[model samples]
Target: MENNFAENISPAFSSIYEEYETLSKENYCDIYRRNTIRKHVETYLNPKDTILEINAGSGIDAVYFAKAGYNVLATDIADSAGIYIKNKIKTEGLKNLEFQKCSFTDLSSIENKKFNHIFSNYGGLNCTNNLEEIFSQFNDLLHPKGFVSLVIMPKFYPWEMATFLKGNKNAFRRWKKNGVLANVNNHLIPTFYHSPKQIKRAMGNDFKAVSIKNIGTFYPSLHYNSLHKHPKTINFLMHLDSWINGKSIIPKGIGDYFIITFQKNT
Candidate 1:
């Protein structure tokens, strides 16, 4: 990652890093994101694999993976999140986890070992405009035949677009632009949404596209906070989402986020 990019964006992430855990607890959507990733990851993961988690905000997923027997090096741009993860590791006596303060594009800073899995959950990679350049780092950091699972926001989501009916055109149309300014903890954070095809192009031929599954397909986008009040409806949506995500009949790249997995070609 460029020094200027990190310098400009660090403050925006830092502003929200402290309250991140609290927000995660309050947000049912976040729980959905984590549950979706964990369920998908279990299908392919082995205990011997090592993981490099990018944008590991609060390291929730990292800790979960570590607990499941994979050693995880969780990296985040925010120093506060890194400190919090470190303290959690200490409190829990979790030796399989490591914390690093770094951006997703800056994995080169770590020099010791190559990882078998790289994970970026819930739109972490969407913060940058340089998908092609940033993805080039993956081949170097991961071992041959290694896998990467990315849960990313794409350029289009039907659920989000449904907001237009409610007179929130701005929210509905945010992804129409190449870049949009998001208010994160009162700070303006620039976010860019990428298509599944764009991510595949960025990864290039060295990596084979394994699968792409919809996450927010039948379920409404997380922005509809009011829907959380209906437990029965939310439960039904969760079951529906699970059933529809991996079905090829469902269109790809239309959900709030999609999970795309790839394996480095040996």
Candidate 2:
């Protein structure tokens, strides 16, 4: 059953990616939500390093990284991603960035190259049914002492738990299940959820955890647009969340996502 489910995963994600590209800037959930992660990248990455971004949705981050002087290679399995990202690169007149169509499972296509840094934002890797395989591939592509940063959806999130307790059982149920089939344009894709410890364990000796920070600790998911109606309130909450997020271990799980940074062993 798992094998069959995994085999059918691409179609569902393809549909989701297609719809995601069509969404207008105002309606795009990733832009505002990814602000925190983008800030982190700005802080850590240097100008000379070569960076590879997996699941480079719409090339937003790619453009940012390229402008910052990093040689950027952005890739995604989505059929529309290449065209969308290329157009973005052209529009921005960014010369340092290149876009490609590739799946996380198959890094062999680009294996001859090594990257100084590798990143995937917004739960892109979590969509895969097998994480260990992906990690193994990542290990191969990274240069010695390279950095790998990923923003992922942990199995437990406070908002989701609270929402579930308030009679929305389906929201809570997604975490309990080890694997879930996300519906995208009438297609089903297998998605795997992991805990922080599980992810660390999977990376094993190849990568060392440098930092693990919480994102959106108080700023709820973008799906809840009702919260955005109050700008002052949302801004206050976001500031408080950012302060507490870096300090507390437990509060990190309260957010919808977490950013985990790992450095490859030299």
Candidate 3:
């Protein structure tokens, strides 16, 4: 069944991925994403800790952590990701960063190893339909009192809803679907959306939420037209977002994504 799904979705996903890779570095959305991940990592991770990053993408965050004195193991299920990350490590001479191809659905291969911090940035965790299974796997991978930080798309995004209301029907419909068939490297990937409450419930009693922040609240999503034409405007929005993002009320559901930090119980 999984193989069939992958085969069906591969072509579309490959094209999507190619486009993503091309725009990732320069896109304002991508820049915000990188900075958000870096901020959370700096807050929770210690210098000597061993960190395991799931869905490491281009391994950019892993390189940052490794450079900061953490031992890093970056994994992604995408075949292209492993080679991309390895080449990056070689080019940068980052000896402390290791690259692997793995999936969140299966951690039996790495279960014996424990990490001081386990992280998945962006919508990596959103790929799974079963949050319980994924959280259980995360629990198994972390040491006692270790941290797990995840960035996921929130179920009710005010900005997205507004975007949709302005006749951006596709944007609105995307969230309404709850689960969508996303293409990744010629593979049709099943993606799930969850509310913050649902995620907390799925983690059960083992993990406790430390903080949750809304990302991209003031700054628009990559698809937003204004961000493309106005550099100064985008920069101004980013600065405003940095100031207002984690406030108790205003920014809660306005962003494109949310970052949630949790700690494994001892």
RMSD per candidate (Å) reads 2.2, 2.6, 2.7
Candidate 3 CA-lDDT value: 0.75
Let me know the TM-score candidate 3 reaches against the reference structure: 0.87
Q: Arrange candidates by TM-score, highest first: which order? A: 1, 2, 3
Worst 10 residues of 2 by lDDT: 21-30
TM-score of 2: 0.88
Per-model lDDT: 0.80, 0.75, 0.75
Give the local distance difference test score of model 1.
0.80
Residue-level lDDT tens digits of model 3 in 1-266: 34444454324333455556656677765776787767876798777899999878777678878888888899877666777779879998988899877777676577557899988887888766678877888777788899988888776666677766578765654465547766565466777676678789999999899988878777777766665698888888777877776556664434777888899988
Task: Show where candidate 3 strays beyond 4 Å.
Answer: 1-24, 174-178, 183-187, 251-254
How far off is model 2, as Cα RMSD?
2.6
**TM-scores of the models, in the given order?**
0.92, 0.88, 0.87
Best by lDDT: 1
What are the per-residue Cα lDDT tens digits for candidate 1 across 57-134? 888788888888888999998767777789889988889999988877678997887999989988888878788777
lDDT of residue 171 for candidate 3: 65
| Ten residues in sequence with the least summed lDDT for candidate 1 | 1-10
